[model samples]
Target chain A: MSEDKLLEVKNLRISFPTTRDRIEVVKGISFDLGREKLGIVGESGSGKSLTGRSILKLIRAPGQVTADKLSFKNIDLLAQNEKQMRNIRGTKISMIMQDPKFSLNPVMTIGAQISESLNAHNKLSKSEVNQRVIDMLNDVKINDPERVVKLYPHEVSGGMGQRIMIAMMLIPQPDLLIADEPTSSLDVSVQAQVLNVIDDLISKKGMGLILISHDLVLTSRYCDRILVMKSGEIVEECKASELANAKHPYTRGLLAAIPSLNETRDELPTLNRLQKEPI
Target chain B: MNAIELNELDIFYGDTQITDNISFDIKQGESFALVGESGSGKSTILKAIMGLAPKWNGSIKVNNVARSHGIDYDFAAQCQMVFQDPYGSLHPRKTVDATLSEPLTIHRISDQNERIEQVMQSVGLDLSFRFRYPHQLSGGQRQRVVIARALILEPKILLLDEPTSALDVSVQAEILNLFKKLRKERGLTYLMVTHNLPVVSFLCDRLAVIKAGKLVEVTGVEQLRQGNFKHAYTQELYAASGGVIS
Candidate 1:
């Protein structure tokens, strides 16, 4: 582990127990992150989401998570008990899931949820907590936060629901945020706006961010560095700007798959599964 | 006659209006797109045309035949829809062969085997994938199966609702190429609803931009190609989609 590394995960492995067989998803993966934004790119079932969830001990029974070294801001995450993990889950490190409908409690008011997160971690007065919730909502660019606070989860649209989710996650003022396909559910136009909101907050707060997505172009544009994962291991790691000229075949395949605005080919090149030879 | 026409269309879910005074027409064999953000009522227009949202005040004439708010067998035989998510649209318990043949069975079309095989090949799906379940196939394969199902009826007008948004980039490219080839071979009319401006430029001949349930502008693909979006809302949408003004 280095001095500037905010998160240092080494040789992490995760597996699930089935009725007749044990399936391993994450296989001895290692990665080190600084205070800047890092993105993990992989297709679904590639163990990308599991890796993010394992960081916060969100992998429950029937699924086992193990690592040689897992540390966050000089704290050993693996050694922490359930009590310590709870205190750290929302207060120090937080995650925003893909779908708001599933991530948010459908019955709870937006304000009540944010306040509940605050109450679990902070010892502030009710007024202080309310004011902080309002401030956080405003920070995420929610106009009329007061009115929005009363709305239930189902009442808000997808984009607004994502914004509210962000506000609730940030209200605790966590040092690290793990977002798993946060903008995939959003419309293309709204995707940029919501990402801009997250990007703005990450810069303002100087928090370490981990963005997990399958979009190669989007990851290149939004992240500082990109990690291309295949079969639970990193195939290539490069600076975001350097991705257009990536070296690895897997990364190249991913980039070539994106349909360019100035497309000339009758058919875009698709990656042959046989070509993915044990990277 | 235009392939599709809508004049003075107004849609309501109960008493609340969703889309207002919308009008557009698509020429025969032309790929037309409707672009808008979520909650901007893009899909509502498609639903209204498909007669899913029955509560509406307008005329939806497809292939010169006026459509009422109900299931029309003639319309089903002429037009069909391909949904966005292959996983959700496809039946988990049903095999790929069953999914493709179901529509033909419903329409009571003869020569089911030949029609299914032809459509399966047209969408570039191999014959081996016909018997596999949706869970056994990849995302790209599932989407291809969905496209094959849509084309099994040999519908002249295809209504695609964000078909590629649910797929991976590489998979999306493959699907896009399939769409291009299918359109070329069949001379099909496409009324695609997508928020992706790049996709519209890649596939559509003309586009209708909607905002807050109103038709803002109807522009040619050439304008989009030259980055010449006239309306402010269209330009804003183009900008938001990562298209920089040069």
Candidate 2:
């Protein structure tokens, strides 16, 4: 393993026990994360979300997560007990979910929720925590942090809500941040803004980021390295700048399927599922 | 003859105005698009045409025939809608056959089985999956079924509200191809509402950009393909979608 690696995983597998058999979702995927941006691109049911959730042991009962090696900063994650895992969850590592509408606490003020995360991870005075909350909100580019602190989640627009979610997750200053489809729900203009905030904070804080999304162009544009997943496995890994020259057929197919800005084809080329190899 | 004509349209939900003074003309067999972000009243225009938006004052015509405010049976036969979110638009308990057959039953059309099969084939859905429920199909398959349901009535004009937005990129390509084929084969007119500029460039002939309930500009798809949008908001949207401004 590299010395600068923030997180490492080897042969990670996640499964759920059904009545008849155990169905595996993440089928033996492995990767190492440095203090740089990494992107995981896959469609629905490809186990990208499952792989992210497994890092923090967020998978619930009936869903079993097993791995040959899963570690953070040379610490074995599998050996940690529930209490120890809780300590590392937000303080050392955190996750930002896809949609803010469901992730944010609707009943609580945005400021209170952000402060709660800070208080839970560290011991700080009320004023200090409040100050950090406002500062974090401002870091995410929210206008008028003082006024936004009192507003509830429902009062903010979708883009603002997502930024607030980012602020809440980022306030703890985790070593690594896993964001799942962070801006998929926002408008195009707002999506660009939210992504810029995430990009800026990731660079400024020197934090490792795992950006999980299905949009190929978006992931390629934002990440340093890209992992293309299909049927719960990584089909291709490449430098983000060379995604257009990817060698894997799946990656090429996906890129071709998306209608470009200067699309001239009478019909976009679709993936030939019938010819797809068995998982 | 124009396939669809909206003149000085005013749409409202209760007392709140959704859109005002909206006017456009889609010629016969033309594929027109309404491009805007969410809450920009693009979908409301489709709803108003479908009689879903009741509080609307406008003269809407289809094939040179004026549309009344109520649900006109004659108009219903000529126009149909394919909604966004194939997951939510479909009924969980209903089979694909049942869903497709309902429109025929409503219109009291005979030869239901034959029509259903034909429409299913037209949308490129397998006949073997006709009895499957919504949960049994993939996102792309579910969207095909939804398209089949819309086409079962043999409508002349299809009102599509973000038809491919909910599907994956590969699936979206297949669905878009299917739509193109259907329109060409059936000589159908399309009024599509979507925020995806790339999709508009692919599938539409002309597009009208809507912003906050107002039409900003109407231009040819060639302009969008060339990133030649004149309106500032349209340029912003194009740039936001990662289009290189030439």
Candidate 3:
């Protein structure tokens, strides 16, 4: 294994039990990640989010995650206990969920929540924590952080709420970020701003990013490499720049489905859902 | 003839005015779009037209008939709406057959069986899905069912609120194509509210950019494709949607 590799997964599989049998959601898949942005793009039940969650051992009971080898910085992730996993989570490999409105604690003030994350991993004075929280908020481009820190989640707009979530995730200064549809809930204009902030921070801190989204064009724009999953397996993997010329039929169909801004086609091409979207 | 017209429409909610001096006209069979952020009162305009938001002061005319300040059954049959979230819009307990039949039964339309079957076929759902509940359907299927419900009334106009935003890219493509086919076949006028510029470019002829309940810019899809917006906000929104004009 190369020293540059931040994460290494070799034939990882995740399954959940049903009444009849266990259904494997994430079939055996393998990949490696350095301190670079990697995008996992797929549909709703494609198991992309499950793959990301399994890395941090976020999958609960009746759900089984197994792998030939899964390591982060040469640390055996599969062997980590719940307590050890708790320490790894939010500090070493933090995750930012899809909706900021649901992820955030509504009763707690923004500053308190972010500060709580910071305090969990590190020991700092209250004044220093406040200063750090304000700085992190500013890093996410929140104007007048002092006032925002005092306000609750409901008081902030959707864009602001998402930025707060980003700030909280980054405050721990994790080695990697698993952003699952981070900007999906925000408006188009706000989406760009939020992604730009994440990009800026990732570059500055030299952290690995695993962006899980259903948007092909968007994931390509941010990631160095792209992995396209269908159902439980990875159908295609290629460089972000080569996505338009993807080899897999599913990828080609997805690329063709998105209506362009200057769409001239009378009918947008659609994948046959009944035939499993391969062709 | 104008299919729908809104003149100086001002909507209020318990002393709080939402939209101010909003006015537009949709020609017969023309698909129009209202594009903006979440709180811009885009959906509220549709609600006001559907009589969901009653506290409004404006002239709302459909097919040259001025709208009164109450429930209009004739208007209901004339203009139907498709909501944003397919998951929430559908009742979990109700089967597709029950859901589709309710509107027809309420309007006292005869030939119920044929109408229901034909509407389901139009939306591309086969007969097997009629008896199935919403939980058994995918997001795309549920959206199609919603569209089927809207079309079962045989309304002249459709008020679509981000109809495909919640579905997958491929499913969205299918739905957009379905909308295109339906409009061409039925000559239906659509008033769609969406923030996705590319979708607006595909399905709508003209679009109005709304910001904080105010109409900032009204431009054709041609101009939007060419990135020829006069307003700064429209340009910003276009840029944000990742303008891939290829």
State each candidate's clash count: 0, 0, 0
Scanning candidate 1 chain B in windows of ten residues, the lowest lDDT window is B237-246
Question: What is the per-residue lDDT of model 2 for residues B1-246, given as tens digits with 9 covering 90 to 100?
Answer: 899999989999989999989999999999999998888999999998998887888788888988777677888889999999999999999999999999899999999999988988888887888899999889999999999998988999999999988888999999999999999999999999998889998899999999999999999999998999889999999999999889
Q: In model 2 chain B, which range of ten residues has the least summed lDDT?
A: B66-75
lDDT of each: 0.88, 0.92, 0.93
Query: Which candidate has the highest DockQ of all?
Result: 3
Quote the positional error of residue B215 for candidate 1 in Å: 1.1
TM-score of each: 0.95, 0.97, 0.97
Which residue pairs show backbone clashes in model 1? none
lDDT of model 1 at residue B151? 85
Q: For residue B87, give model 3's deviation from the true position in Å.
A: 0.7
In candidate 2, the residue pairs with backbone N, CA or C atoms under 3 Å apart (3 or more residues apart, or in different chains) clash, namely none
Docking class of predicted structure 3? medium
TM-score of chain B of 3: 0.98
Q: Put down candidate 2 lDDT per residue, A111-229, tens digits, no spaces.
A: 99999989887899999998999899889999999999999999999999999999999999999999999988887889899999999999999999999999999999999999999
Q: What ranges in model 1 sit over 4 Å off?
A: A18-21, A273-279
lDDT leaderboard ranking: 3, 2, 1
lDDT of 1 by residue, A16-54 (tens): 988878888999899988889999998877899999999
